[model samples]
Target: MDLKPLLNKLENYHTEKPNRVFTMYLNTDPADPDQQGGEWRLQLKNGLNNFETYLQEDGDSDEKRNYWAVKEKVQHYINENERNLKKSVIIIATADEDIWFAETLQMPVKTEFFWEEQPQLRQLKELQKSFPKTGIILTQKDQVKYIDAELGTVKDTALYELDLDTEDWRQHQGPHRADSNLGSGGAKTSKKDELAERFEANRARWYKSIAPELDQIAKKHHWERIYLVGPSDEVNDLEQHMNKKVEGKINKNLLDHEETKVLNEVV
Candidate 1:
């Protein structure tokens, strides 16, 4: 999801009475130690119940009715999505449905609830800053894999391999699995070794060839940070040619790993 547009819209939103917004941030990660024994369920119930009790005691008729409507909707949403909840869940809505936004995010969030004229966005903004849109470039020899991610979740991915004949990078739909035998013990490595040898000879030029595409992808994805992970020489050579700044670099090949594993190890 693109946050720039959504955040801008939410930041300007305001209302009163019937349109009062309800904002919620729930930490639902089962692995989180604090959530052991399904404690978040009780927290959520208590939070909404507190709001209901307060509205019952002191709120005007419209305010109480609106709060009740929003409360029911919120309860239904949570129940429906409980099984699919991720590390966190965020929701902002009004009883009349003038505005509604809900998302299950891979990133963690502190549990909080608000009933106000505008959606509470401080935590969401913090998540955006902490886990901004990122492009992870993984390289080995003549292949490059790009993982586009935001808020700690993989968004999209593509593979690009340099065609020796054309000296041009060819985009592939998915990851290019690394050859398992390349570095295994006692295996004949003539073919791949020869290719790697050839690539090493003109490594600078080859890396330079793909650098422009990296910059292009970063621009297209609006990546705030770009990380390159691969052989030291590949990372250095590519950085020298690319206009985009490298946020981080790791001197090890990880293109063959699972997307989540690679992301955790690299960033």
Candidate 2:
């Protein structure tokens, strides 16, 4: 997303007039902060009422209209955009009854309103510093698990499952010593090398098959960052085969950690 144009536009906008900017950071999640604890609807009402009180005291003649318009707009935005009801909402508007920006964010924000010379971009900056849209791909030799994870709020939901072909990976004793050149150590070494090569080939094939699927799932989830957890060889192979989007967003892989402990490692 290109922000230069938008930033330039905003810079040009407020310079035109004393635009009464209203900044609201709302806790849209049903589990509101303890200070405003109640059911979701009640919490929303309380938040808006708090804003209304502030505007009534600090605002001018058009304050009532601003209160109603902003209240309706904010409520409608929350209802329309929230999916998991685990996200917070940020709305920046002008007293001229124009909504400058509104966004549903994965991480929670303290419910507060700010009246400043410029729009409140500090919160946005903080959010960008700690992005919440992330996905986890935990890969082992034979099985792959995809988890939709959010960094800030510790949200980890198992989304899809991809079980790869495991036959080649399974352990099996090589041909009996008698089957090889009898009493020949060179023959045993040759057998071991052959088995290792075949195992590597099978693992390569597995990587090739699953890399695209993993990429597709990450795109589907709109993950801004991807965390890989797997063996060193497999992780390296997957990185080479991953699509440009996945490759660009790859966070460091947890090659030293087991698959089961990825959750602990990521958060």
Candidate 3:
């Protein structure tokens, strides 16, 4: 979800023709008071129709054909994904389909559309600024999860679990949905007190051991802000060992929750 490259691509995107690019920014959040009545549908209808009207008045047949082609595909995409629509939907496309960038983001966006030479990017840049790339670290005792996110949507995830036998951290990268193995290394029958005592004695040393790996991940993701979520004692210990500064800390052991829920709680 890094926007710098995409922004650069769209910034310089233009054609010798009069107008062939289409950009759309729709605020589809039902929770937003302004959008409670499903007004975006009407706005989109009117906005698109207004563009067609303008073209009919002053645009040529070739331009009109191109515009209609792009509009048909855009409308189909929106209709198909309307049920999964989040707070905002942003799309920038061209007539020939050489460049198509679309995203459904959890963040809000101003409802706007453009039929111009280049993509409308001022609002997009500001949105990225408000919720830049971030890493939300959820740590309990021996496990830490990193959520690589931008503009309130997750891009990637990595789980770091301490291999007690090797006293080394292991990294697993993907959308690992299960959190059953957080506190223990698959030792579900082990007594809670036993596990607690074992980690309590070596918590600081173990966390310190994995701190450098976390720093490496931070650099790899170019995280703008890091939020540590766990008990204050565990979070504080890990924060001390990390070279990068933590932007926020939440005192709650949320390792077993769903990632999106965990992200919502932490970030």
State the C-alpha lDDT per candidate: 0.85, 0.57, 0.83
lDDT per residue for candidate 1 within 17-68, as digits (tens), equals 6558999999998899999888889999999998889887875889888988
Among all candidates shown, the one with the greatest TM-score: 3
TM per model? 0.86, 0.50, 0.87
Ranked candidates (TM-score, high to low):
3, 1, 2
- Model 1 TM-score, 2 decimals: 0.86
Off by over 4 Å in 2: 1-19, 27-36, 39-47, 50-64, 78-84, 93-106, 115-117, 132-135, 140-200, 205-225, 230-233, 240-265
| Model 1 spans > 4 angstroms off | 53-80, 95-98, 174-176, 180-186
Model 1: how far residue 134 lies from native, Å: 1.7
lDDT of 3 by residue, 1-267 (tens): 568778888889887565578999999998999899999899889988998999899858888988898899889989999999889999898888977888988888898989888888988899888878889898877788888888888898778877766878888656653542334445565565576777889889999988898899889888999999988999999999999989999998787677777777766
RMSD per prediction, one decimal?
2.8, 11.1, 3.1
Q: lDDT ranking from best to worst?
A: 1, 3, 2
Task: Tell me model 2's lDDT, rounded to 2 decimals.
Answer: 0.57
**Cα displacement (Å) at residue 55, model 2:** 4.9
